[model samples]
Target: MKKNIKWLLLVSLSFVACNNDDETVAETPVTAGSANFSKYVALGDSFAAGYSDGALFKKGQDNAYPSVLALQFKQAGGGDFTTPYMEDNLGGFSSGGNQVPQFPRRSYFNGAAPATVSGTSATVLGSHVSGTASYNNMGVPGARSYHLLAPGYGNPSGLVTSPPTANPYFVRFASSNSTSILADALTQQPTFFSLWIGGNDVLGYATSGGDDSSPITPATGVPGVGFDGSYNALVAQLSTGGRKGVVANLPYINTLPFFTTVGYNPATLDATQAGQLNAGYAPYNAGLVNAKNAGFITEAERVRRTINFVAGKNAVVMVDEYLTNLAGAGLPSYRQTTVDDFIVLVSQGVSAKAHLTAGNGTAVPLQDRWVVSKDEVALLKTATDSYNITIEAAATANGLAFVNAKAIMDQLVNGGIRFGNYHMSATYVTGGAFSLDGIHPSARGYALIANKFLEAINAKYGSTLRPVDLGNYQIQYPASL
Candidate 1:
């Protein structure tokens, strides 16, 4: 009986030891925060390129957030990062087709002489050119999230179309057929990544006056992609071994200078012009009034007119037309009078009307038509809400950290953030944050954005990345001004 008891006890001990081994084999140990991000990869659209003042020039590219962020990362013990850069010096539109001149570059302050065009070359720049651990920054301007997976993405000489075919930045670092933006990034097996996409997804529509809804197919809605599928795919690929990363959400373009610069003032109207406007000769003015009373204050106040040529129809309110008409009618004798003089006169209203001198005097009829209205504000808010919903949903499902860029933009417009000791607003020309096109940001503005990203990173990953110094960036002004 004692021998049998000993044998039973030995078998039980053996079974317990085997069970422990099985448990240990099934459960793999994970290293927390081991994904140190020695290799940094940035992916996004025009904002990623540091496009400012309606153009992508060398100056803006050099001061781009990715480059700035790379500098910060290197100082923080991260590996050196690389970017696919353009060779073009003159940073605006370039001529491609026959006889059609490229869009002229204008000063963000005053429309001055057109900027020179720069040429682009087909070449890559970085430490490693043909391997998994290759280029770091692949932030292609004007690229959609879906475009990352397309096969012929890096063709520089392809037929240029909407969202243009040849992105010189992408063409520079493009590898063999086996390598792609998404595939290459994945192969590198990055420990850390930064993605700021979905801006261009709605940007094209907004810039085209909502006239071009071409991007909205059956597959995607207004905000498009809902991006759930792509988000899931990316998470599956990148988070396979629990890799971590940060993602940025879209901001409301309406909050930018592009939409806010053109406003109108009904009280500044002259008696004769007011009569015409009241009679509906200026239908846009009427819309602005309706929009204002309805609570629209900015770009959302502009009515959308199907006809491009007709005035006062469905279109955004433009203060220029009324000012032009007033100047032509009120001061016929003055030669070579400019819009600046008119703006000055209109801004002062009736208080400075007596200071008018025929030729040199700045006084003229006050016409307020360039400002935004209340209805337009509502429209912008609606668009912003829709976009944020899509962005938040994607981030949540994918376990990616998202920055509320729209809220940041609103803060900038509402005078909540101070950059370089200057309060930033959406006002054109005078606003320190935005460039001349009233759409894109200045170098200082991009710095503010970089700080926002850093804040989000800290929140999501418990990182202590330092904020960018806005003072280091330069703010260029037109020499003519």
Candidate 2:
């Protein structure tokens, strides 16, 4: 009886094993569903172009989110997606054999700091790509919304104009000298599209320390003038004939690592140094007090403007134009930075160990261009919110999928979003999300963004598209590449 029972158990176990072997977990086949992706074109600025490590290169373009999406779309009948490929990985095109100072090579982590890659690129300013559809990507870096609608924005001749009316990236693949970004994209008649613009509208202003070099686009104006009107026009034109697409809203540009990585208090000083700095500002503090007494300023304003330093990490002094024009009274709008202020990333080099001795941010107050005051931050927030409203409205009115990029940024800042076992945040290089530039995403970060796009596309279109494994993408590219 024992032998019979043992044989029965062995037979039962073998049968279960055989059943498990025959029943495999099947993957959900990719499908386009109600949406057509046969001819898909992506339209946006730097993010859409995969401008990682502070510059655009071949590898970065290859891993762009649109390219990643196109590969997945191929499973459902999407055709070949063409890109305006850069000539080399060195980036920074030359004009007439002279390297354009504005455009520079890609940056990589050199164990201690972000360094520009060595080598010259063959990409020229007026040189056009050989193919016709190379503009399928249509992502011109440094483009604003209004720039997309302007004629001759890709005209190489305009590259020499004051303030540069043309973009070099667009000039590389534009069909004609007179063609606009919208025109080139519309000529493709893409069945599916993605729009993620308006960041540059305010990004320039924020990065330039709210300076005049790059002004923020106003939210209210006529079509082709204001962000609202220009965005609406873009949607209306793209939605002609009921074409389906996705629209992603702008994230809080001020919160990006370029503004957030550096703290307000990078001015570390010993007790002796702090005392000496305080002594130097004594006359200015006295003048602020006298100005308050003379009705030139309020007591609160006086306190805010008073520059004080202590032993340890003291807030850097910066020029605040918002302060009362005490310049007439021998005061130059000087104030110590607070938590609300952000020292621009470029200020890091200015406040380096060598320069700190020269008092770039201590003895000599940091210029307005090195700091984004609380007032400047408020301006950025207002513009970003206004632009997002127009973007969300366009998406809803056109029945297109919407990506809440602001929320994603919030997630990256608050406690990071996880993909598989890897987690990413906005904590600069260590966060595994933003690249060495501290503005754009790493390769793995872009892969995560591609997954987010897939999620929105599948939910909106009823497609069962699969997300690529996050493990496949690198968190950071090596300097060798």
Q: Which has the greatest lDDT?
A: 2
TM-score of each: 0.64, 0.93
Kindly give the stretch of ten consecutive residues in candidate 1 with the minimal lDDT sum. Answer: 332-341
Tens-digit lDDT string for candidate 2 (158-196): 988987888988988988899899999999889999999
lDDT of 1 by residue, 1-481 (tens): 9999999999999998978965663463322233365777776777887777555655677777777776766644567776544434334443332212332333444354223233332222221234434567766767765656655566655435566555555655677433457776776667777777766655554554433343321223322144434444544565556666777776775566555443222124345543543354344445444544655434332333111222332122232322222232222211112222121211212211232222112123222222222333344456556655755775676666678887788787786577447676666556667776566777877887887776776677665566666877655545232
Scored against the true structure, residue 96 in model 1 reaches a CA lDDT of: 38
Leading candidate by TM-score? 2
- In TM-score terms, candidate 2 sits at 0.93
Steric clash pairs (candidate 2): none
Off by over 4 Å in 2: 1-26, 96-98, 347-358
How many clashing pairs per prediction, in order? 30, 0
